[model samples]
Target: MKWHHVQDNWPAFFEAILDRWPDADEAELEEIDGDQRAFIAYVIELTGQEPEEARADIREWLSGELPSDVVMDPRHDNHSIALSKKYVPEGEDEYDDDSRFGDEE
Candidate 1:
């Protein structure tokens, strides 16, 4: 599938599940975790979509023609703005130079 090429470009993404169902919070997503029935049920519960319609939506989402706006890099995604506070400022070392890694000294 053409998606093979897309996957080759972004090894980290198996699906843009979050992008498609942003209302599905992280915890629920973790629980669903590729279980088709669970996902379908959740979709129906949240959106009142028919079972067949939900299945079709999933198929289209996983198809070769992936959406262009789904971000592969979290740093560039809109959600990144909320995470910026955790980022270390430029010209500042997050770890001491003498430390082998960032392990607590």
Candidate 2:
């Protein structure tokens, strides 16, 4: 995957940019829209990184596969959650201690 990969699916991959730059505001990121020059400039503005380093980092960031954890859509999110539903009973809060799972019949 590259910049074009993200450009083609902005909403799906937008979280990816956030993963890299958690300090970045989502609103500001939306304005970037995956343009290479714009992203590098934004990163530079955000992190104060030199332009050369920012360019390299952005390239590296965009080169990898979209993580499995990325929820591309609500339907895809269901598929990922389906595999975990057995261990985590429906409607159980995620923060709750799941240690009781082993005690179940």
Candidate 3:
């Protein structure tokens, strides 16, 4: 499947990928230009796991069995964040006045 498809179907796994390669320097992690083998290799290095183990782990995580200790970075999980914001009740401000959201005043 395409990378975006994978990201949509397996968001946690995508989040893990983005956690490893932040968008600050790499703009588009979704548009990774290569074969699955290369991507698998990258995943192995990123997660510090054996090839077979990493693949199996990723599969499990994608299937909604994410480990309790696997914390997803908000900076990378934009889809989930956006969804939360979209569904948040009116008058309930979840975010602080951070520069990341632009001018506070």
Which 10-residue span in candidate 2 carries the lowest summed lDDT? 96-105
Q: Where does candidate 3 stray beyond 4 Å?
A: 1-4, 7-16, 19-35, 65-105
Ranking by lDDT: 2, 1, 3
Which residue pairs clash within candidate 1?
Answer: none
Per-residue lDDT tens digits for candidate 2, residues 1-105, read 656657766767667777898888888778877676787789999999999988888878867776664436877666656656677767875445546777444
Q: What is the C-alpha lDDT of each candidate?
A: 0.60, 0.74, 0.53
lDDT of 3 by residue, 2-104 (tens): 3444534443345555654443123334444434565667667666889898787556545653433344566546545566786677886545345665766
* Candidate 3 weakest lDDT stretch, 10 residues: 23-32
Q: Considering every candidate listed, which one attains the maximal TM-score? A: 2
Write the residue-wise lDDT of candidate 1 on 1-105 in tens digits: 244433444322334666777776667766665566776798887778998998788668767444445445755553555455468677764442535665446
Best candidate according to lDDT: 2
Model 2 stretches astray by more than 4 angstroms? 67-105
- Between 2 and 3, whose lDDT is larger? 2
lDDT of candidate 2?
0.74
Candidate 1, 105: how far from true, in Å? 31
